[model samples]
Structures are given as structure tokens and as C-alpha cells.
Target chain A: MSFLRTAPAFRAGLGMRTIHTSRVAAVQASKQVRAIAADETAGFKYTAENAILKGTVNDAVAVPTPNKAHGSYHWAFERLVSAAIIPATVAAAVASPTAHPIMDGVLGVTILIHSHIGFSACIDDYVDERKFGALGTACRWLLRVGTAGALVGIYEFNTNDIGLTELCEKVWKA
Target chain B: MARRFVQTNSISEMEGLKLLNTQRMNRPVSPHLDIYQPQVTWVLSGLHRITGVAVAGVFYVGALTYLLHPIYPAIDSAHLIEAVHNLPVWFKTSAKVAFALPLTFHSFNGIRHLMWDTGKGLTMKGVYASGYAVMAASVISTIYLAFFV
Candidate 1:
């Protein structure tokens, strides 16, 4: 009844005063953790750069806090480990961009072996094709087989730096 | 009379055939993984798989290192030496161990491949024997080089 009975001017004045007071209080609260500063929010939500831009005009800025479980020491240890691993990881990348040529040579030998096997397969197919008719399904299969083998042989011939003699030696040794 | 003679021969041959059963003739003689007790060979085989994986992993890391080395020139000799000096003793030791691992694997594996080439260690006995030697050599050389030098 007291609020309702107040004079119109008085009520209007009180209403204005209440609005001002509440706004001031809100402004003050916003200055602390009001999500006003993106940087502050970034500490909580995003990377350092992102948080800085995302905070609200009325928000108070706060940095991210680690989970309660980690405590102080765990964070410190994580940083220490990162410092150690990041460098060596970088160095090893430089020494050999690809497999060492020595390893490649081994692989090359493997290719040569496969090529020879392919060549034999081709010869088998050719012989089979000759024995059978050219149009028959079995003869067609033989032709395809021989062609694959020949192609492999040609590829091996192109890539192989090792001479036939060396190839023989290596294969025998294997 | 002729039928009787034939019958006698057929019966004798059947007896001879029973003596030469297929299972007896075709059965494998050598030890299989199932029959033999596990030994150094098994351990060595496990180690081979592990080392193979490690070698591949080492290569991957090595590749990444090489890629980054150019971008980050800070890893150059003077910087690296400085970094080494700055590192704790434990880290330095770890670096030494890491450095030796690939070298030791390559060396031991090379020798193994060489033995295989000579066709001397293809038998099971020879395989187990050489596997032990390779394992021992790899471990000893790795430790000696890592810790001492």
C-alpha cells in the first residue's frame, strides 16, 4: 500500500533511481567475470588469442584455470616433457628426408626378384598360349599372364642399376 | 592251379603294402612350434618383430626430424651443442640411447642377412644359435656405445 500510494512524481523518481542503481551494480559485476573480454574468455574457452577478442563489454576478464585434478606440479611436468620431445622430433626429420639409399638398394633387389618371377610367369603363359588356341578362354588367360610378366621385366630392366651378374650374386646370396 | 598261384602272390603283396602305411611314410620329422618347448628362438622371433617395428618407427621419426631441420635452423650444430649443454644429464643420456638404437639394429640385422646369404644358418639349430648371438651383440653394443661414448 505504501508503494502504491506514493505520488506519481515520487514513484517515477524512485523507478528511475532503481534502474540507475541496478545498472551501476551490473556494470560493476560485469567488470569482474562478466564475459566482457574475449581475452579473458579465451583463457577459459579457447586459445590465448581467441579469448582476448571474445570477452563482453561488461564482462570481467579471467584466464583459463587448469582442472582441479592436475594441481600445479602436473602442468609443470607437462611443459618440461614438451620442451624435450619437440626438438629431437624436429631434428630426426631433417637427417633423412626419405629412406636411405642403402635401404632403397635393398628394395631394388626385391623388385628385381619380383621382376624375374614375373618374367618366368610370362614365359609360362606364352608357352601355354602356343600349345592352346589363340581365341579360347584359356589361351586368352595365358596371353594376359605373359604380357604382365613381360611388362614387369621391362620395368625391372629400366630401374635396375645392378648388372645381371650382380643380380645373380645377390639372389644367390639371398 | 594258375589262379591259386596268383592269389598267393596278391596276399603277400598286400602284407608288404600294410607295412608301408602312408602316414608312416609321409609324416614330418622336424619339430614344429606346437611340439617343441618354447626357447630362445621364440624370444628371438618376438624381438625381430619388435625391432622391425622399432626400425620403421625410428625411420618415421627420423623423416620428420629431417623435414623440420631446415625450417628450424635453430637445431644446427652450434644450437644443438648449446641445447645439449643446457639439457639435464638424464636427457643427454636418453639422447645417446636413442642415437645408438638404429645403428645397433642395422648392424645386427646386416650380419643376420649376411649369414642367411651364406646359407649356413637355415637349419633350426643354426637359426636359434645365430638369433641368440644377434640379440646379445645388439644389446651389448648398444649399451657400450650409448653409455661410454
Candidate 2:
């Protein structure tokens, strides 16, 4: 306890009270995020509020420093991929898959990336690493592995068997 | 003095802060609208995700199984088509619908989402108009694809 002082609650959107925190306290202020006060659920720090913010009343909020990869650039890239899938889908539907082997592969890769992004969003929202910790980390890595396997599988299927369109048509007509 | 129903008590600053924080915790973490409700707007939005997950899940599973073909030598698309073809007509029809419904719905809703990305059809009236259009188109297309085509 070399120092003691009340700092402004700039990051604490929950309340405006000046939090009492030292430099050390500020560093340790990031409480486990919880949504419900029940402590079992993973979300904003609620029930654990007995220790305001972190361990002090005016501890700095633990908001992540902005990075472009997970910020606007991420949003733009997702939109671009989704938009590209539209034309790819329409073309794949129109063209003969066996004749345009490249088209089939393009569609397959787009679908894979799209599915990966979409499911990753679900995992981020529900089982966020910030809250679920190890479970979330494992789920993310598992998805990556699954995606990689599926990519290779798609390549193998396209090369060995009838491409995606022919398979769908044969199954539909079957 | 008039009969009083209210009571007042004084507490230390720390105690007051703790009380305030506890109350904040119990407070509902919502403002105007509830998080989830079964209305058309919410229901349709939820379906978009559900259908996307279902369709993509199937695709992923199907694609991933291709990797097993090398080991099993039987887990390939040729077997898959034959299996589907061998199923009873009713089962086939049901399976077709099951597969087609999500594909159509997700496709239509996905287009609607793309329209939104372009900053179009975002108003309340526009949203409902586009939503109803997507629903109608999906149902009709699914029926045609499943039964007729």
C-alpha cells in the first residue's frame, strides 16, 4: 500500500462513482465477466459487484484496446465474402459443374469460409473466451481443425467424384 | 404528524456503495425491448440463424465424411446418392423438403441481409415488405423444388 487515490470512472459505463484504486489495483481490476448476479452464468460482472469494477470503486474498465483485425476490417471482410457467395451461388446453379470444375471448387471454398465465419460468430457470442475460458478456446480450435479437414475433403471429392452440382442433381433426380 | 408509511435509514458510504452495486446486479439488463420474444420479427431472425446453422452443419458433415472414404473406401458421394435413392418415396419427399426448406429460406433471407448491407430496405415498412416477400418466395420455391422439380 504505497499509494491510495480515487480515480475517475471513465470506463465504468455502469456507474459514475469515483473508484478508489492504486496502480496495482487498476492492473488487477478486470473481474471475470458475468451476466447474471447468480455467478453461474457467463456475462458482465453482476453478483461479484461487491468488489466494484475490479477491487476498487474507480478501477479502469477492462475494454480491449481496438485492433483492426477484429474491428472494422473484420466486418468489411465478412460482408465481402457473403456478397461474393451470392454471385458464386447463382453461377454454380447455372453452369455445368463437370465442365467448369474451377467454379465448383470456388463455390466449395466460399461455402467453407462462410460456414467457418458464421459458426465462429456463434461461438464468440455464446462461449466467449473472455467468459468461458478454456472451453471457448477449445471450441474455436476444434472448428479450425474441422474446417481444414472439410477443405481437404471437398478437394478430394471434387477431384475423384462428380463435382458438387452433379452430386446434388443426381441425388435430387434419384 | 400524519401517519407515515416511509422509513429512512442512514448508512456508511461503503455500505451505500455496496447496496447500490447489488441493486445494479439484480436490475434487468435490458432497456426497451426484451432479449428474446416469439414475435414474427424475432422469430424470422432466429430462423435465419437456425436454418443457416442446419444447412451449413449438413454441408460440413457431408464434406468432412469425404475424408473417411480413403480409410473406409465406401464413404463416398456415390453411396450417398444411392442411399437416398433407395429410401421410400415418402421418406425421400420428406428428406427433400427438409433439405430444400433451409436452403431456400437461408438463401432468401441471406439476400435480404445483403440488401441490408447495401443500406437498402432497412425501414420498418421496407423490412416487413422484404420479409414477407422472402417467406412467400421460399415456401413456393421449396414446394416446387421438393415436389415438382
Candidate with best DockQ:
2
lDDT string for model 1 (A90-132, tens) is 3333334133333333343343333333333444544433333
Q: Please, what are the lDDT tens digits per residue for candidate 1 over residues B51-145? A: 54455344333323433444675533344345556777777667667756654664475457555755768898888777778877877887886
Clashes within 3 Å, all models in order: 29, 7
- TM-score of predicted chain B versus true chain B for each candidate: 0.56, 0.78
Model 2 chain B poorest 10 in a row by lDDT: B29-38
Global lDDT of model 1: 0.47
TM-score of chain A of 1: 0.20
**Interface Cα RMSD for candidate 1?**
32.4
What is candidate 2's lDDT per residue for B84-142, written digit by digit as tens?
Answer: 88999998999889999999999999889989989998899999899899999999999
Query: In model 1, what lDDT does residue B146 have?
Result: 62
